[model samples]
Target: MNPINYLYLSALLFTIGGAGVLFRRNAIIVFMCVELMLNACNLAFVTFARLHGNLDGQIFAFFTMVVAAAEVVVGLAIIVTFFRSRHSASVDDASLMKL
Candidate 1:
């Protein structure tokens, strides 16, 4: 298939993820949408790397994956902690930063 098609799909996935992030109230759902956006970016990166016959985009994508993995670890920890304390995973319910 064409590289442009991959890019188009990536854009669509990113758009859907962005909309979910913006409209969703559930923390887990927002987190999932963020992951979806990251995966869309990774797809675009791999597609571009193949198109250009280079490893730069692939390297960037790898780093992104690494960061995302760390984010998942820490993010889930926080979410679980908040859920245990507040009993709700809604973003609006989190005012944990309140003084």
Candidate 2:
């Protein structure tokens, strides 16, 4: 398969995720969309690494996954805390948080 194809697929995934983040109101769905974007990036990274016959991109993707894991931990914690207080998980509600 051509590297350009992988790049196109990555762009498509990232665009879908961006649209989801922009249009979705639910916190969880938005979070998942962000994850989708990250995975799209990972896909591109791996494809390029393979094309170049090098491991650097794959290593970066590994670190990206680690960072994404940490993001999920902290993001879900905050979401859970907000839900506990408000009994909802809408991003609109989170915008009003003060202090």
Measured by TM-score, how close is model 1 to the native structure? 0.92
- TM-score of model number 2: 0.94
**How well is each residue in 37-97 modelled by candidate 2, as lDDT tens digits?**
9999999999999999999999999999999999999999999999999999998887665
Clash pairs of candidate 1?
A: none
Candidate 2: give the clashing pairs: none
Which candidate tops TM-score? 2
Model 2, residue 18: distance off in Å is 0.5
Worst 10 residues of 1 by lDDT: 90-99
Per-residue accuracy of model 1 over 31-80 as CA lDDT, tens digit each: 99999999999999999999999999999999999999999999999999
